[model samples]
Target: MTTDPPPEPTGAPAPTSTARGARLAFRRWRRTRPFWAALWTGTGGFVIFFLPMAPLGQILQVGVGGIAGMSGGVVLMAMALLILLLPGQRHTAGVIAVIAGVASFPLSNLGGLFVGMALSVLGGSMAFAWLPEKPARRRGGRGLLRRTRSAAETPVPPVSVGSGSP
Candidate 1:
């Protein structure tokens, strides 16, 4: 005996919210090398600019003013923005960020200098190391949907009546 197929679902699938979609997209983007580099470089630069550090005179025994100690951080932040905005130019931006980070050593006090330099260098390296991933090619000629056999193409076995004789 044949049985009927299960009934189809009564309602439509749940709709995804725009906010959730946006969040998912953002999460995916954050996983990329460029995003991490931009984040680290930007955060490092901001820290250097905001955090208090030893006075220039105390660190280098020079008469330079406090503003001079924050210039490297500013450069780092600018380069990070460039990398984020124009990923195609990441190599150039990364190189500039590295140079600016190194230069920050002499310009800034010890506190911001080491941390800022380390973060900026790491970010720059990440940017430089980024390589575009290639898309995978689909295999086989089959479409996404599965093909079902037509009723005519399916063969049915012979159904016999109760016959006791061999």
Candidate 2:
């Protein structure tokens, strides 16, 4: 019998090799750990760290407050890295990240104008709540109903009907 090629998907154009590779690579990386949590946490940390030091068209001077804010941001970013690298320590990292985010408010320009604080808190929450998915169980056949042995192969004995008193 002559073999036929499988039909291509409709509506969407085929992805280029580089695009496909990148997508697959990202998917693989994301599946292995809490990628979003790490990214958000790092972003929040960056904002918290840099906002205080940034000069608003004037002589820039980072004082003790800036230092504190920078420290908090660094802690948050470290926590994010911890979560990404050591997923087992996610809970600890998450808690620390949240605390750092909250602490950054007074220290880092109102927690990077609240944006950084929000991102840090959100990222920490996600890390804390993240859970591994269970693998699906597979059977060797299709359809919902399972195959069973024939009734004749496992016959049931007949029961006689008797009408008298017990």
Candidate 3:
């Protein structure tokens, strides 16, 4: 007698709405965070340098602007680098950085421009050093490793028996 055929399996379950929402959130974060951060950092750096320089004639101390400006510069640069590194938002960052730098000039009597520029460089450099680079990953070497290990662990197939050999 002949046997009956097996039944077909049904399709996979659809992804839940929560998963969909999470995915959407992730996309937005990836797309928007970088630009916003870059802008914020640059603007903050500008303010750090510009705001303190008002009242155009007072004896502006070296320590006053230097420390703050330098620090601000580092922050701004980091933000810029982050925008680039983050892979989503440099356009916003670039625009904000330049605009803020320009704005700082008038706001802080041209001192902010210098300070912001300095900070941007310093921060960007530091971020560059910290960010991971290419040329550090494995390509197809896993296949070789797997073959060697399998040979060691598994036994060779048995030889034919009809020849009467031991």
- Top candidate when judged by lDDT against the true structure: 2
Give the TM-scores of the predictions, in the order they appear.
0.62, 0.68, 0.31
Higher-TM-score candidate of 1 and 2: 2
Q: Candidates ranked by lDDT, best first?
A: 2, 1, 3
Summarize candidate 2's per-residue lDDT along 1-166 as a digit string, tens digits: 9989989888676668679989999898777788799889999999998887657433236567877888898998899999999988989999999999998888888999999999999999989988866677776655334356556666679977795649
lDDT by residue for model 3 over 1-166, one digit each (tens)? Answer: 9988887655754568679989999776555344444544555575555456445455255445444544444555555666756643455455555554444444443545465544444433333333223445675698677767855687789988799777
CA deviation > 4 Å runs, candidate 1: 1-16, 31-33, 52-65, 111-113, 140-166
Clashes of each: 0, 0, 5
Local accuracy by lDDT, each model: 0.73, 0.86, 0.53
lDDT score, residue 80, model 1? 90
lDDT score at residue 112, model 2, on the 0-100 scale:
92
True-structure lDDT of candidate 3: 0.53
Off by over 4 Å in 2: 1-15, 55-62, 140-166
Q: Which residue pairs collide in model 3, if any?
A: 73-119, 74-119, 77-120, 77-124, 78-123
Task: Please report the TM-score between candidate 2 and the true structure.
Answer: 0.68
